[model samples]
Target: MNDREGGPSGLRQRTRRAVQAEIAATAMRLFLEHGFEATTMEQIASEIGISRRSLFRYFGTKEDIVLGDHAENGRTLKAALEARPADEPPWEALRAALKALVESLPYTPEDFLKITGMLHASPSLRGRQLEKRQQWTELLLPDIARRLGATANTMNELRARALVACALACSEAATETWVRSNGTVDMERAFDEAVAAVRA
Candidate 1:
C-alpha cells in the first residue's frame, strides 16, 4: 500500500500489476527450483502467501503466470512511439521507442531465459506466443497504416509492415546476442547494430 517502493502515485491499477508481476516471478522461481512440470499453482500461491484462486485471478493458467502480461509492453511501446518528436521520421521514432523500451524492460535476463525455455519445451505455449506476436503485429499494422496515411492495400502499408518485421528481426537478434553474452552485452548497442544492419 506504500506505493510499492514509492513508485507511481495511484496504487490501484499499478498495485495490482505489481502484485501480478511478483506472482509471475515467484511462479518462475518455483518452476525452476522444483522442475517445471512438478511445480503446481498451489505451491506457487502458497509460497507467495496468496490463495490459488487469487493466483488464478491474475493468471488463468500456469503458462499465463510465467508469461506475465505483455499487453502493457505493447501499449507502452505504442505510446512511446506516438510521443516521439513529430518531426522525426516514423522509423526513427520507432527505433528510438524500442531502444528506450529495451532499457526499461522489467523482466530480468533470468526471467527471459525461463520464458524462452518454457516456450521451447511446450508446443501449446509456443503457439500462444506466436499468437500473441500476431496480435501485436495486427495492432502495429494499424498504427503504421495511419502513420503512412495509407490503407493496408497500398505500397505504404507494405513498407510499414516491412519496417515492423525488420524491427522484430533486429530485436530477436539483439536478444540472442544478449543471452549469448550472458547479459553482459549492451542490448541497445546490439539492437542498434541490428537496425543498422537492416539499413545497410
Candidate 2:
C-alpha cells in the first residue's frame, strides 16, 4: 500500500475530513428544511449522532458551515488566478479563475441554488458572506495587479482593486441570478454576460 494512503497521519486526516463533510452535509439539510435561522447547532449535531461540542470543533458556527472556510477559499482563488496564463487579459484570467473556483464547490448544482437563494435572502448570512468575501480581495489583488501591469500609483492601485472587485461582484451576481431564476438561468453564461456588460 502507498505509505501516504495508509500511514497513521493520513488515516487520521482522512477520518477528520470525512467527519467534517458529514457534519456539513447534515447541517445543510437541516438548514434547508428548518430554515437557517430556525435551525440550531444542537439539532444538527443530534441529527448527525454527534455532540454539539464535536460539531463546534468542525465549524465554529452555522454560518461557517454554510460559507465553508473563506480563508482557505481565498487561498484557492489566488492560486487559480496565479495559474492562469501570464499573457491572458486580466478580465479573461479572472473569468477562467472563477470557473476553477466553481469546480471546488462541495454541493451539487441543485443544492447550490437552494443554498444560494437561502443565503441571499438571509440578512445575517449575506452580511457574513460579504464580510468573508472581503478578505479574499487582498489575496486576489496582487495577481490582478500583475495581470494589468498596474503599479503603486493611486490610480493604478484603484484600477487593480476595481478589477478584482468587479470580478467578485460578477460571480455573486451570476449565482444570485441563477438561484432567483430557479435554475433556469445558465450561471456561466450569466457571469460572462455580466463581465461583458461591464467591459462595454
Candidate 3:
C-alpha cells in the first residue's frame, strides 16, 4: 500500500518492507510459542498494535506471515546469484545464492529452527513455502537462463525454470536436513550434500 502510494520509490518500498519484516518476525515468534494452528490474525495484529484489517493490508493470510518476505528475499537471492563469477557452473552459483540468503536473513539458529519446524508440521505452511520457492525461481530465471547460454524469452523460459527448480529442490532438501540436525550443520555444506545425492 505504501509502495503503491508513492509509485514504488526506493525509500518507501524499503520502509514498507522493513515494517513487513518486523511484523513477520514478531508474528513468527508468536507462531513458535502458540503453534501455527493456534495463532490467529487477531493475536498477531494485537501484538503488533495493529488492527486485524490493517494486518491484512500487509499480508493476506496467516501462512504468509510465518513464511517471511518472499519478494524481498527473492531479490536478495537474485543479487547473490548475479554476483557469482561468470565462469561458475549453474548449480554452484545457485549454491552461493542460497548460502547468501541464509546469511542475510535476520534469524538466529534457534529462531530459524522454531519457524522451520512449524513449516515441517503444517501442510498449509509447507505449501506456502513451496509457492515462495516458485516465486524465487521467477526472480532467478533470467540470470540462470543467461548462464545456460540461452536468452530469457518465452522459448527458453521453461528450460530456465526447470534448472532453477532443481536447484531450489536441492536447497529445500538441505534446509530440511538442517532442521533435522537441529541447525547444527553448515547450510552450504548441507546443500552440497543434497546436490551430491541428486547427482548420484
Candidate 4:
C-alpha cells in the first residue's frame, strides 16, 4: 500500500493524477486560445513551469496532450459497461452503459463542443480521435464478450466485436446529432432515438 513497497500509494496516485489534469488543462487552454497548430510543446511546458523534457515524460506529442482525457474516458466507458446487470440483454445493457458514459463526461456541453470542434478542424487531432475510438472498442471487447456469454471461438469473438461496434456507431450518431444541433437537443433523447433506430 505504501509507495516505498513497489507502486504508488493512493495519495501519490491522486497527486500524480492531479498534476496530469493540471497539465492537460493548461495545454487545452493554450490550444483553444492560440490554435492547436500555433501552440508549441515548448510553449506549453514553459507555461506549466516545466522543462520540455519533463513535459515529454507526461505526453509523447502535442496531439497526445490534447487527447489525454480520452484514456480516462475509455476506462470509464469500460467500467460502466462492466457494471451493467448481468441479466440485461446485450443491446439494452450497452445502451444504458453508453448513456452512463456520456453523462459521466468531465466536460460541460459547451466545453465538449469546443474540444470536439478543435478535433474536427485539425487533421492531426481528427486522426487521433479515430485512433482513440479504436482503442475504446478494444477496451470494451472483453466485457462485450463476457456479457454475451461468448465462447473462445472465432464466431463468438466476431459477434461480440460486432455488437460493440454497433453500440459505438449508435453512440457516435447520437453525439453527432447533438453536436450539430448546437447542444439544443437532449443528448439522452438523441441517444435513445439512435439506439432505437439501430434496434429496428
**Using lDDT as the measure, which candidate wins?**
2
Over 4 Å off in model 4, which ranges? 1-16
The per-residue C-alpha lDDT of model 2 at residue 136 equals 87
Cα lDDT for residue 188, model 3? 77
What's the lDDT for all of these models? 0.73, 0.87, 0.85, 0.84
Best first by TM-score, ranked = 2, 4, 3, 1
Pairs of colliding residues, candidate 3: none
Q: For residues 39-149, write the lDDT of model 4, one tens digit per residue.
A: 999999999999999889888998988888888889988889889988777888888887787789778878888777778779998888878988998999887787778
91-112, model 3: which lDDT tens digit per residue? Answer: 8899888888888988887887
User: Tell me, what's the RMSD of every candidate?
Assistant: 5.3, 3.3, 3.4, 2.8
Prediction-by-prediction clash tally: 0, 0, 0, 0
In candidate 4, how many Å is residue 126 off?
2.0
Which candidate order results from sorting by lDDT in descending order? 2, 3, 4, 1
TM-score of each: 0.71, 0.86, 0.83, 0.84
| lDDT of candidate 1 at residue 25, scale 0 to 100 | 78
Query: Weakest 10 consecutive residues, lDDT, candidate 2?
Result: 1-10
lDDT of 1 by residue, 86-151 (tens): 666767777787867666776676776655565556776666666665555655665666677655
